[model samples]
Target: MMKQISLMITSVALTFAMNICAQQSPWDKADAIVQSLDPVTFPDKTYVITDFGAVGDGKTLCKEAFEKAITICSDNGGGKITVPAGTYYMNGPLVFKSNVNVHLEKGAILDFSTNESDYLPAVITRWEGTELFNYSPLIYAYHVQNIALTGEGTVNGNGSKKFSPWNNIQTVEQEMLRKMGRTNVPVYRRIFGEGYKLRPGFIEPFGCANVRIEGVTIMDSPFWVIHPIFCNNVIVRNVTVDSHNYNNDGCDPESCRNVLIEGCTFSTGDDAIAIKSGRDNDAWRIGQPTENVVIRNCSFRSKINGVCIGSEIAGGVRNIFIENITIPKSSNAIYFKSNLDRGAYIQDVYVRNVQADTVRTALIRFEPNYKGERSAFHPTLFDSFLIENVTCKQSNECGIYMAGFAERPLQNIVLKNVTIGKVPTPYCFQNGENIRFQSVKVNGKKLDEKPTPKELVKLRVL
Candidate 1:
């Protein structure tokens, strides 16, 4: 009998070890998708802007020059349009074509004029999650593939004193747009420009594939610095952004798939990296989810969350992986937010190997009461979150704050090998289910509870 019992214990231990080995961290599983991304390529031909009558003296209106250059490049089956080192003042929008690369040399600056009228002939865009025809993004692309904006240069919006002030009177217009989204107005009919005060994103690539924006320094964005909507296979690498205007999220990827945001630095006014799908009814109508996104090797300094997942994610967001991040300061380190009005789901989110100096609010937050209406069209669900190997030096509020509705309790969460140096409250959970903490230390003490050994065996084996 003793021998039988010993054999049984040995078998169980071996099985447990094998199970641990077989279960891979979410980051590892994300590698297949990340590695599958292909770098954009361009033809050998070069179209120098100066060769097309573009002057570098900063006072020259280079709209026609840029238009002519891009057109010539596109007509010749696509190649690189080089902008040499000087201030190239752009009076209007620059639209890119497929297989084209706009390469700027080290001292090149593409300064956009702040005159609102220059952005006339509105284009289809989303403002605060609502789909409409708004003013054209400074650098806009639609339905193009293998397009790039590369080289070590700067794209300046020049929006500080002019564009940021539109928020003061945007209250009524904002409400009207939200109403339009809720009422399911035809997207083409929701036009706002000329007299409309809605701001446009600085660089928006809509419905594009194989897009790359690399080694560029962007500043003073009118709105979201880099907004990629309805795109696939996107890469924003080695980019530096410093935009502090209103609604100046560093990078906002909406309704995109197969995205990789790596080796970037951001100091912005809003969330450093906000992954969004769409808003409310419009999202439901569009019916496209945002998935297969990987954000890695980035440093963030922002007034809002370092990595945010919603408030506009009504079409659902899934299969997101964040790793090797450093956030010096922010309101929240990782925030997953949605309200009653935005009835989307957030799932399969993994955050790992992060370091933060100070988070003004919680290190991690999940709130179901974001700014929107409550509707039964979709039930808001937040689940399947894994956070490991994260360390934060300080937090003004609780270390972790998660609240779920009583009907749909947040479920299947695991936090392992985490540490927070200081926080007023280490943990705050309300209406959560199946939350597990293993080796999670807050304020120099391990969390006060853990699952029983029998229950531990049943937790998700991650």
Candidate 2:
């Protein structure tokens, strides 16, 4: 039995290696990044939607059909449940069991019907990592292993039909509700339980293992798209995620591990690529960090952040790498936000070979105000952040802003081979220590700290 188990493990490892390259060391740059993931077999099987009596009725709510199909697939050895080419108007969240793959074929759409009855509650899920007992997600994969949602189809979280897709409006509402001294959740009290209480984002795989989402379009989620919280060995590539409405973050890797997001296009309202752990007490409870994540070969447009971290990091995070990216036309290019209330430690993040154009807040932003969101009164630490080979043009404020509490400072944050539209002064560089600048430039004029003039000339020529 032991030998058989060893052989099975070896075979799976070999297959994974053959599909991509051998797994790179945590500190080493990958030799090559694969654009797609080859299917790996576990106990999960492939299930057809036609078997569950779905007739592709746009008006008809196919909740029962989808539930039946997922049930059937679960009863079997846990396989893939396919939605063929047509419109499947599913009403609430369709819960996926472990080892189930929800595939939507070409020209297929999993439309979310905007009805309260469709969203039954009392299950465990989150919005920005806050434990919630409200409406469920459009499609949820929780605590699963070796799972996926692939193929050329669309998962439409019909949020526009419900919530107000403007951040200013929602932010105002949240503040007004907070002033009113309401006891319920801020999202509920904000709208007085009337509006779509902020349509929760679609496509959340929570606490899953070995997940993949590729070759699909995730559009118009009321919230963040492709949120995988506390998952491991995940890959999201070759997907065009376009949610232009408010709070419509493209992809949020919150408290996940060993993730690779590459070859994707993101046009969103909020952060195009976000890293989170959890929010406040909920995050403190989970205490899981999103680590070993790589975001490469991607493009972004019309979002708040090209790449961002925090605003919810009750748990610590480390070992993040974002490389070979393009950010065109965004409010802010790269951002990092945190507060003392989070009680999380962040370290060892590297961003290299990034190119951005026509952006607002380019280069880097690490601020206590965090773009005027909330207060910065906690004790938080940020260290060992390296940004290199980055070129950004056009932004509003200072190129790089690192301001934090006096005690918990931002240290050892090296900016190497970087250039932005303009340069700005520091609020206080006392705590933001060990900030080395090598071969740096501002709007293409090379700065003085060029370690080697020959090497700097070569770099500038390129």
Candidate 3:
């Protein structure tokens, strides 16, 4: 009898251990993804821009010198193009070649010219999710592999003086572009440069692999600051962005896979980090989803969202993990927005360990009717979100807000250990199923039950 009891106890212990091992933390996959990434490294050869007849007087145009140096470095099989201290004026874009690392030493600045003519001779680029021939991005790369932009230096776009004013006039052209996208127009014919006012991104690497942008200070971006489109195995680390111009989102990773963004600081006019795929028919044609992204240890003080997932997510997005975020001030702490015209699935997102103060809107929000633009009948499926261990000091609006389409409601969302200190309203939810809250507190009151119909606020389109 004693032997049988001991055997039973051992069996129970073994079963418990097996169950624990089976229920691994979701971050284990994140760790494996990080381990799978390959760090970008260049050859030991260093080509100094000064030696190539580039003047750093902040007045002379060094476009030719840059072109010459980059070409030579690239021809020599791969190396570092080093820029020493001083301000270097660039009249044109810095078009990158494969296997080149642009390293800027401390106190160095690459000041881009504001003249639109400097960016003439349009390049094949994507503008706001639609493929077009447009002015080249300030730092542009296409189909390059193993590229990097690193150093403790500043890249000044000088955009507020020139491109910020164009935002007021871009509405008509913007609508035209969206219409073209909705109509499935061929990407080759969508040309808008020279006379068009659509602003270009600051740093864009399109269709590249194994890219890195680290330790750089970006400022005065006309549009999105650091945008990587259709890229794979990219890393953006230890970067600082302080651009407050219109549409100057700090970083946007669009249609990318296996991306890692960490140790970044942002003070932006828009979202600190916005993940996007493509838009409308253009997205459907491409059929690429943004997936396997990890963002952590970031600080934000934004005029808009702290971390956002699209108003341009027509292509699907999945398997995103975000943690250890601090938001001193923002319009919203966490936001997810999509519209009826965007037909895709955004699922399997995990967020934790976030702290925010002075949120102007809700701490967390899900809006399926974003912008109220219904050019098509396709509706996005918003599902499978797990948000936990989030705390907010105060919110000007409600604590949590959700609005989903009746046809395709938000599904399988779980919030655990979330607390909001002060808010006028606690929650506003509509058309969401399998939405659960555990240990959730708002306005110092525990939300133990589903909100009543009378408590649901009308949808206020942002």
Best-matching candidate per TM-score: 3
Model 3, which residues run further than 4 Å from truth? 1-22, 449-462
Off by over 4 Å in 1: 1-21, 372-378, 449-462
- lDDT tens digits, residue span 254-369, model 3: 99999999999999998898999988888988989999999999998899899999878888999999999999999889999988888898899999999999898889988887
The ten-residue window of minimal lDDT in model 1 covers 453-462
Better structure of 1 and 2 per TM-score: 1
lDDT by candidate, in order shown: 0.88, 0.70, 0.90
What are the TM-scores, per candidate, against the unseen true structure?
A: 0.92, 0.81, 0.94
Error of 1 at 431 (Å): 1.1
Q: What lDDT does candidate 3 reach at residue 272?
A: 91
Model 1 lDDT vs. the true structure? 0.88
- Candidate 2 per-residue lDDT, tens place, 313-334, comes to 6677788888888988776577
lDDT of 3: 0.90
Report the lDDT tens digits of candidate 1 across residue range 292-324. 999999999998889999878988999999999
Ranking by lDDT: 3, 1, 2
What is the alpha-carbon lDDT of model 2 when measured against the actual structure?
0.70
